[model samples]
Target: MADEEYISVEEVASIMGLSVRQASRYAAKVRTERINQRVLFHRDDVMEQARLKGIEHEARERAATYQPKPTKTDLVPAGEMLEYIRERDRQLAEVQAQLNQALLEIGRLQGQLTDHQQIRQQLTDIQSERDELKQAMERARPWWRRILGHD
Candidate 1:
């Protein structure tokens, strides 16, 4: 409450509705003009100064509402975060390579399947031609001659 009392820079700023820099400036002025050295302000003098600046009541009201955002660095431990990112990248690269290889193998299998289908069609055609030739030979043979041909 007196000039000799010590208050933190943040406390002075909240009391004055000023930024820390502004509060510090006022503190400096008080030191030069009234107090001989840097020290806490008397409660009465701080109120009077706040009144003169038109921020005394407003500062006190806003002080309770102020909420600082948590810094990004604080949310995650630095070492663990770095390791997690590196591991994720490595896994992604490995998965990509495996996907590429799988696609290549699929293409190769498809080609072999096509070749096998063509071969099957050709074998079916050849069997049909052979059956037709055998039928024609049977029709051309005379029954008596066919019966005596073996002897």
Candidate 2:
């Protein structure tokens, strides 16, 4: 036992190009010893088993397809992000100003419409009063004068 070398499960994982969990399962198929609540396997035995199972080829294939995640350094800087936000806010404010201008124009047009309606109503009232006064003047005039067609 002293002459032979023992490797930890983590070392077996690295050697087999497997994750720790996969390495643990693989180690169970071979001879394993528990020491200090940690599983240890003979490195030579683990490598031989991997060669027999053709796992080394699969590990190589997985590595070829692996892509690491992007880190914080890959992101846009804080100043650039703040500038983009400010630009968007400026565009939004311009749109809001145009909307407010349209609202003011609509209010002005509505005021003109109200003035036109009042003017129309006053014209109608004036026409009614003119008709009443004409009728009263006709009644006041003598019937003989109307027959003569004189004003």
Candidate 3:
């Protein structure tokens, strides 16, 4: 409050690990400023809140570099990974080929089905025509032939 310097809620949220809305709520009792629609609080007030929440502002220096000791089972060898990928790819290719063949077979079967349907329709038409012709012939027979049961 003495310095009158204001920090944006975004900085407070980053330092405190709280959301902007939460930081704004924490800064409610502090002096605030609005610049370009950003809610800002006095820098000292933000630091005071952080201190009261038991969060120290000090950065600890690491004494030594970190070395990971992962077990052998944790990592896969590059050669084995490559071989597995190749096998998966081979299986996928075989499946794709089979799928293509199946699609072709389906298309051929559909064509055959269409041909059979057309043949059935043609046979029906021919049978209907034959029946009509036989009826016409019966009508053309003379009365004497009809009485004698001759054609």
Alpha-carbon runs more than 4 Å astray in model 2: 1-63, 69-77, 147-150
lDDT of 2 at 107: 100
lDDT of 1: 0.71
Task: Write down the lDDT that model 2 would get.
Answer: 0.78
Clashing pairs in 1: 1-42
Lowest-scoring 10 consecutive residues by lDDT in candidate 3? 58-67
TM-score of each: 0.48, 0.48, 0.48
Runs off by more than 4 Å, candidate 1: 1-75, 145-151
The residue-by-residue lDDT of candidate 3 on 1-151, one tens digit each, is 3434776676666666677788779667777887788777876676677677777353001102213345586688879989999999999999999999999999999999999999999999999999999989988999899899986
User: In model 3, where do residues sit more than 4 Å from their true spots?
Assistant: 1-76
Predict model 3's lDDT versus the native: 0.74
